[model samples]
Target chain A: MKGVTVLQSGGSNQMELADLSVPESGQDDLLIKVHSAAVNRTDIMTREGKAGYAVNPILGVEVAGTVVEAAGSGSFSAGDRVMGLVNGGGYAEYAVMPANRAMKIPDSISSAEAAAIPEVFLTAYQTLFWIGKLQKQEAVLIHAGASGVGTAAIQLAKQLSDAKVIVTAGSRRKLDFCRELGADILINYKEQSFDEEVLKATDGRGTDLILDFIGADYWDKNLASIKHEGRWVLIGVLGGSELSKVNLMPIMSKYIQLTGTLLTPRSDSYKAELSKDFAEVVTPYLEQGKIRPVVDSTFPVEKVHEAHQHMEDNQNIGKIILNIASAEA
Target chain B: MKGVTVLQSGGSNQMELADLSVPESGQDDLLIKVHSAAVNRTDIMTREGKAGYAVNPILGVEVAGTVVEAAGSGSFSAGDRVMGLVNGGGYAEYAVMPANRAMKIPDSISSAEAAAIPEVFLTAYQTLFWIGKLQKQEAVLIHAGASGVGTAAIQLAKQLSDAKVIVTAGSRRKLDFCRELGADILINYKEQSFDEEVLKATDGRGTDLILDFIGADYWDKNLASIKHEGRWVLIGVLGGSELSKVNLMPIMSKYIQLTGTLLTPRSDSYKAELSKDFAEVVTPYLEQGKIRPVVDSTFPVEKVHEAHQHMEDNQNIGKIILNIASAEA
Candidate 1:
């Protein structure tokens, strides 16, 4: 199997394409012949040696592929098209994961599109419904409106409930993209304070839920923009990690809830449960063309380095995918 | 009617007993002839002019009394013994509150005993069941074990679920009281780090739920002592609220949730609903004598100042009550 291996260079991550043995499939696992994989910010950090990774690390976290082999009594069969989140070993010709983590993709969705679904969609679905508990007619504020998870969260919040979805992006182009995806209010965070804008948009009541990626920079603002009994779900700390002497008085007064979560590092059973629930709820919407993938661009597997660069540059509006298989499959 | 009034002296609170007119009962209200009232820490703050209160503040929050007048079509009749949480005016000879806020007290309970039930028990019930969602076989850590809310939480957590209850208190006596109320592990926080003790008690996995009233002082330690997906419910900031540049990385990695709540300042309907729920779940335990009030001492209404001083000095083990009516009555 041909795959990308991370090499350390003066404490920096360097990627190399090399030949490696195929990973083994365990009982109750499916051996997937990966067709497409996606590049995420975490991948860039892992590659740069900033985020921790194991020895002989495989870089990709999400894959859309076909099951080449299935353990008996598994939910999937050989040759079934699937998309899923893998703990690791995704940026390769084949990857093996527990059968429950994989979801069958409909023929209507392309492999590249399916590859974009797993991490972003699952994270969005879990954050809004499972973590945020977004109710109908409640409002949600999603930061980084143009990012993969943010875009997916906006669409999910819109389609799943009658929620007023607000978004904050750095550019007008990203704001416009978010508007097309059903964002009710788009604030150019670079030009204006999102907290003030959110207050204005919601008539001073503030948002019922917030999806935050920028931690330290938005910590106080996020607190200020949340309504009574609202939830502030922290997904990423892109800006920084240290929060300075935060007064929890408002939290008590407003009865706010702050929770932090990640999709990776979860148990196989936990991932499987969320995956099953997501497939049941979102599959019909995907098949009916109500919700679709937002693939920013695609790169050949040989161009894996460039895929990491693309996400690092923060230019992509949605998922940046790596085409593992040849164009003709 | 006679009621306690807060006098401001050099920006500090001074208590005085004064003559006042009885409060009016609305169409859906109950006019209670007060028998006994409980002194909570919040009352001390409101009395000291530390916690914000409205003009002409009345101190008491919880009370047991007889229904002197029930508005037409209300739930209670004249002379019915009841106990409830009043937003204010519990210090007066008569207090008027909505009918639903008051619950009929059983004959097995004394007026002072019933007076101790509303605020602390309701807070404990709401925190453990409603916020923490404590399940069977889970573990809970209740800080300030001998305090009114802590004592109630210890009892409720033990009676409601088969949970292993751990407590952190300042003294041997407090720890003993907690143990009698069914604490599996007791850590004298004054002698050692609760986080380390909690880890040891839970075999390094940590507690599933934490009922915290001590804020900033226990903030980091509380984070360290929680298990994966554990909930830390904050009710007060007795220790302090100034948390300096705290790192939120652990919250993300452990998938922890931190929520802040207060029983006061809630809408009438919301409080009524929770009151109803508490009555439904804990009434059986109360009837079976599985749960009982831990009243520390009683002070006549004229000696209300001493009651406040007792709670302020943290000298009481459980709830301190003010007997408003004659002992024979």
Candidate 2:
């Protein structure tokens, strides 16, 4: 099987497409023929040698594909459509996924869109609902609003929950896109101070929750922009990781909560729970057209580097996809 | 009316047993004849010229008293026993307390014990349950194990939830006292590293939640000791307010929460809700003999200076109370 792998040789790891033996299904797994895969900063950071990611060299965390074989007895079978979290093998043509992680893809949605939904939507779901405990009439501020998870958070927080969605982006173009995704307030972070804008927008009450990607620079601002007993959920640190001089007095003084999480590397049990939650609470919104995956760009699987480069440059406003199949296939 | 007042006439504040006009109660307030009072670190901080306290010349936060005059239309009568949180006036012989913050004292409890219940217990309850979201079977790490709030938290965490309780104290004696108060794990922070102790106790899974008062000193250790997706609820910052570095990477990496709070300055409406929660959930535990207030010593009301000195010297194992009357009455 032709697979996308980052060879673990020397100083820094980089990807190399090679022919490796396709993975076999575990007792409760699904052997999937990959249709599409999406890019994440986790892939980049793992490639950069920060974390000890899954030993396998494949760089993708999200995928959609056809279940060519079922591990044990389950609803999915040969030719049955599915989408879910994948191992490092997501960038490959064939990958074995935990059956519990895979949810049946709705017939109406395309494979590329389905692939984009899992990682970003699940991250947004976990941050907004599980960690933030967002309630009706509350408000949320999504930093890096143009990114996949940020865009997904905007849609989910706005459509699914009654939260007033505020988004911050580097450019007006991305701001406009986030506005289209139902952002109640948009801030061009490059031109304006997001802290002041957020405070102004909230009438100094601050948002109920903040979804942050830029870590230290935005940490205090997020704190300042949070309402009393508010939540600050961190899923990524694009700007930098060194959060020097964290003054915790503000958080305690206001009864705030600051949480950082990675949906990747979660236990299989937790992944199963997220998959079920997605199928029950989120998928209907997608199927009914109330919410949809936001795809920024698509590239053939061979151009995975370009997709990564595109996302790394901070140019993409949504999920970047790798088309595993030929254009006409 | 004779009252215990701390006067901030200049750079330094002085505690004085002075005469002041008696307070009149509103429709929803009670004229409490102060029988006992408990001093908190907040009062000490205010007396020592710390900024941001709500009221001036106020000495105490928790009060236990008889209803000498029932100006309100509530349950308390002229001779009914009660205790409640105060906005600052608990040091006086007579004070006007919000009816909601006052609760009937159990027959088994004394005025000193009742006085000790409001500030420390409520702070512990609010941080552990409401903010930290501590649940049954989880693990909690509390700093300052011998302090009033710390001992209260240990007892409550053990009694209310099935969580494993861990505490860090300055000495072996204090650590032993915390163990006596139902702490599952005790760390003498002076003898060894509390972080290492926490890791050792939890099988390296770290704690599910942390109740922290040592602000800047325990910042990184708190980050290191909490499990993934855990919460760190802050109530006070005795060590210092400003941290030299605010590294948010660990916060994001482990999904930990860092927040601090001041319970006394909270609005009346919010306090009412907290009082309701205490009445429903915590009050029953007290009556059921599962939890009790830890009182260190009681001093005469005229000895406000001595009580403040005891708290400042950090000599109390639990709460220090001011007694309005002796055994002779």
Candidate 3:
């Protein structure tokens, strides 16, 4: 298998395409012939030596592929097109996906689009619906609205429920893209304060749920923008991590719940459950053309460094995809 | 009717015994001839002009007494003994309690004990079980374990589930009292660091749930002592409210949930539901003599100032009760 592997000799370095043996599919796993993979900050951080490196460190965590082999007793069969969470081997020709995590990708979307859906879409779904407990007629404020998860959250939240969706983005273009994705209210955070806008928009009640990716920079504002008994789900810390000062009094007085969540380190069974839920809820929406994957750009697997650099520079508005298969294939 | 009232002419002054007319019971309320009242920090703060002032502000929030009058459609009848949460007027000889908030007191406990149970016990019950979502066999760390809510939480958590209860207290006496109440691990915070003790006691996994009142003082330590996906329930801010510098990365990495909760200011129906749950869960324990009220000291209603002074001084081990009537009554 040709895959993206990090060179362990260097302190901080680039990912390289190298030949590797195909992984054995576990009893409850599917051997996927990966068509495409998605570039995420985790991959960049791991490559940069910021996050801990894994043994035999392969880069991508999200993939769209077809099952080449299925373990006995698993639901998936050979030649079935699937996309979902992968255990670090996604930037490869072959990857092992837990049977529970893989869901059939509808024929309506392309393989690169399917690759973009797993990590970002599932993250948006789990954070908004499962952890944030967004309800109909309630309001949600999603930070980083132009990013992959942000775009996915806006679409999923808008289509799946009657909740009012408000979004904050850095640039006007991203805000515009979020607006196209059905965000009810938009805040160009570079222009104005989101907390004030949120308060003013909601008649001082603040949003019922908040999905924040920028941790310390937006921590106080997120707290201010949350309603009494509101939920602020933290999925990423792109802005920063050290919170200067957070007055916990409001959290108690207003009954606010600040939850920190991540999709990467969850159990395989949990991912499978989320996969089942994602298929049941969002699959039909995809099939009906109510939601579409927002692909920013695609690169051949050999250009994995460029994809990581693009995401690092915050140049991509949506998912940056890596086409694993060769043009001739 | 005679009641304890704060003199509002001056800024944050004193409590005084005042003569007042009995309040009329609402359609769904019970007019009770108060036998006992519980002195709480909220009452002290209100009297000190720290919280807020109400029209004819009374100093008590919990009471146990005999029903003098029942509204047109209430379960209570004249002469029925009841204990319940009250908005105000609990310090009065006659207090009005919502029928839903009031529950019949068992014959085993005294009126003072019943009065001590409402605010503190209900706060403990709601914080530990409802907001904290404590599960069986999980570990919980309770701060201020000698205070009213702490004592109640320890007792209730012990009787209801098989959860391990770890407690932190300021003094040796308080730690001893907590141990007597079935606290498995006791950290004398005055002598050693609670975070170190908690980490050691939990075997580095930390506690599953934390009921915290020492806000800013324990903010950082609380974050350090929480397990992955643990819940930190904040009910009070006795130490301070301003958190200096908190590293939110731990919260994100550990998936910690920090919730700010309060029993006061909740809707009547919400309180009623909590009241019903409290009664259903803990009432049997009280009846079976498995749990008993830990009353620190009882002050005569006229000496309400002294009780407030004692609580403000942080000298009491458990609930400070105000005896509204003598034994002859």
Candidate 4:
């Protein structure tokens, strides 16, 4: 099998394409001949040696392909199309995951699109509904609006609820792109502060829920930008980690809730519950033409390094994917 | 016309039951002839002037009374036996308030007991269900177990859901009292660390919800003691307010939620909603004999200064009530 491996940590100079033996699948696992995979911030972090004892300690978590071999006890037969999530080990020609984690790809959606769904869509769905409890006619603010999670969140917010979805991007081009794709209010952070803009747009009441990625630096502003009894969920902390002394007087005054979550490391049962929740909440919207994953760019599997570089630079307007070799019959 | 007034901040030395004129009721107002009142930790804080501006900025919020006057536009009328929350005027013969802040007190419950419910019960109810989203069979940890809020929370947890209730108090005697009240586990913080005891009780899973008062000092411990996806609600800062730095990584690693709430500053619509929620969810439990407010002691209205001092000395198990002059009708 051909795959990308993280040789060591440090910069974008680490990932290498190499030949490796395909491993056998367990009785409950599906051996997938991966057709495509997606690049994410986690991949960049993993490339920089941040897996932190993840079982596989490889890289990549999103994949779409045909099952070349199903462990005899599995439900899917050979040649069945599927896409699945993993803690890592998806940046390969063939990967094995628990059958339960692999879902049959819809006939209406291509494998490339299917590849994009596992990580971004699940993340957006889990954050908005499972965690933030976003509702109709309420409001939400998504930071990094051009990123995969941001784009998926906006579409999910629009499709699942009649929420007033607002987005923040670093550039007007990205802001305009998100606005056309259903964001109700778009703030270009480079031109104006998102905190000020969100306050202005929400009539100084702040948003009902906020999907935050920029951590500690935004902690104070997040407290300021959320409404009375608002929920602020941080799924990523690209900005920084430690926060300066917080008075907490604001939390009591505004009655704000601050929570942080990561979906990948959660136990299987919890993930299953969240997966069911996501399927029930998002699949119908995807099936009907109510919402769709936005594709920003694609790279051939041989050029997977370029895909990683693009995602590392955070230059995409939506999900950046890698097209692997065609599925084996 | 007479009311309690504060001469200045700092202990009961500043709290005085001085005379003042009663004001007229607005369209949404009620004028109650106070029959009894109570002291809360916040009252102690207000005595020390820590509750800087949440109250009317004129008087503190506390109440127990008869509806001497009502505007007929809100929820009550003249002559109704009432006990409700107010920001600052309950230690008086007359108190004016928005009608919705008052709840009907059943004849089965005394004025003193009724006076004790508003601040603590409401706080616990709002924090546990509305914010924490605590569910049946989920484990909950209540700090200061014999304190008014702790006692009420223990009863509410036992009555409302089958969740395992755990508590921590300053003394073994206090822990014993909470244990007899159905707390599954009790930790005497004076002798043993609560987080370790909590871990022992929960089989190393930690608490699903934690109600904390001592801030900064207990910040790290609360984060460690809470389970994955658990909620930590901070209602007070008795130990201290300033933390040198906020270790946010722990929150993300544990997927914990941090929230702060102030009951006094809530709007009429919000409080009314909360009041209605209490009436619907909690009042029935009270009526069914499943839960009841715990009144530790009472003092005559003229001895409010004494009541304040008693609370200052931490002399109550549950709530301390201030009774007005007896009437022959």
B1-329: candidate 1 lDDT, tens digit per residue: 88877767322137777778888888888999999999887777676666675333677888899999997835789999999988788888898768887888988999999999999999998899989899987999999989999989888988889689999999999999999999899999989999999999899999999998989889989999999999999899988888886887888888999999988667778779989999988888898889989999999978877787788788798999999885234
Per-residue error (Å), model 3, residue A44: 0.7
Where is model 4 more than 4 Å wrong at Cα? A8-18, A70-77, A104-109, A276-290, A326-329, B7-16, B26-31, B44-60, B69-80, B97-101, B104-108, B276-292, B326-329
Residue by residue across A134-251, what tens digits does model 2's lDDT show?
Answer: 9986889999888899889999998888688889998889999999989999999878888899889889899989888788777767877888878888777777777657666677
Candidate 3's residue-wise lDDT over A1-329, tens digit each? 79888885342245688888888887888999999999887777667666564443788898998999898735889999999998788889999988887889999999999998999999999999999988876899999999999999999889988778899988889989998999999999989999999999899999999999999998778888998899999899888888777777778878999999888878778898999999998899999889888899999987777777788788798999999986226
- Over the stretch B63-169, how does candidate 2's per-residue lDDT look in tens digits? 89889888755677889888888788778878888887778898888888999898888889888887778899799999999999999999989988978999988
Sort all candidates by DockQ, best to worst: 3, 1, 2, 4
What is the DockQ score of candidate 4, to 2 decimals? Answer: 0.66
What lDDT score is found at residue A219 in candidate 3? 79
lDDT by residue for model 1 (A212-299), tens = 8888889889989999999999889988889887887888878999999988767779899999999999999999888889999999
Alpha carbon deviation, residue B98, candidate 4 (Å): 5.0
C-alpha lDDT of residue B221 in model 3: 86
Measured with C-alpha atoms, the lDDT of residue B100 in candidate 2 is 78
Question: What TM value does chain A in model 2 reach?
Answer: 0.95
Better of 2 and 3 by TM-score: 3
What DockQ values do the models have?
0.82, 0.71, 0.84, 0.66
Which rank order by TM-score, best down to worst? 1, 3, 2, 4
